[model samples]
Target: MTFRDVVALWLVKEKRATDVVLAACDLLVAGEGGEAVARLAALTRLEADIEVPILLPEVMRELDLPHHSRGTVEGREEGLRAMAVRVLSGELTPRELTKWTHRMFGHEDEGWRLSELDDAYDTQAVDSDEALDAEVMAEVRRITS
Candidate 1:
């Protein structure tokens, strides 16, 4: 999908700000070498009102990505690396991440339910920390570590 389409999907369909941020981060990371960095810079500018200090780091941790302090080049790079790791590890698939972002950041729909996505993707079964097996736990640790 085009960058604009990805942004539209995240904002219009996901409705969760956190999801949108995460998906955007993933896209930035997956793009061409320096392109990801440039995309991230642009996204940060576009969402400046969203407050990177309060959002990006937490989302990074949630996605099993790395965290960095705000407003620094190193922090930006680290955050992107974290996003890349999450994408590679199956912790967050691109499509699933996009869908979640659409719901999280998009307009509010009182009828929206996380379960709806659950049923549609059948992919979030791994999100539960309590339900993970030893192997899964190890993978989680590897991702976090």
Candidate 2:
């Protein structure tokens, strides 16, 4: 595999390990060794990126990152804004942008994002969610008239 893919894989693994260790520490702090063991065992069965926000301060400390950092959030918002611009410019397809938005932001409403773009361009909404409603309304009027 390429260096980029390998680096991504390593980061994923590191995050999972950190999560598992943090989980154990949490349970131990609560005086639940048995629960810790059980939870740790279950975690070993799954390959996932789990994050406990309350434990993140410690994790950030270990990583030499500030506990309360806005740079990351601001950077992410800028990235999404850039992606929106690309979609509007046809540099990225709507389908691809929708997928990326969902992956990046977890359930961001794509139609709403597209609507923002339509407004920005002073154009009619393209590929609108109202297509079905408009068609159904047309049929209803036809039947009534």
Number of the top TM-score candidate = 2
Q: What is the overall TM-score of model 1 with all chains considered together?
A: 0.22
Q: C-alpha displacement of 83 in model 2, angstroms?
A: 0.7
Question: For model 1, what is the error of residue 110's alpha carbon versus the real structure, in angstroms, after optimal superposition?
Answer: 47
> What lDDT does candidate 1 reach at residue 135?
32
lDDT of 2 by residue, 1-145 (tens): 2211222222323223444454555555666545323444244323323433333445444434334322354334434444544445556665454445445545343234433433433343554535533432332233223
- Candidate 1 residue spans exceeding 4 A from truth: 1-48, 76-145
Error of 2 at 136 (Å): 22
TM-score of each: 0.22, 0.28
**lDDT of each residue in 50-126, candidate 1, tens digit only:** 65335444444444544444434444333333432454567665444334424442323321232243333445464
Q: Relative to the unseen true structure, what is the C-alpha lDDT of residue 125 in candidate 2, on a scale of 0 to 100?
A: 50
Clashing pairs in 2: none
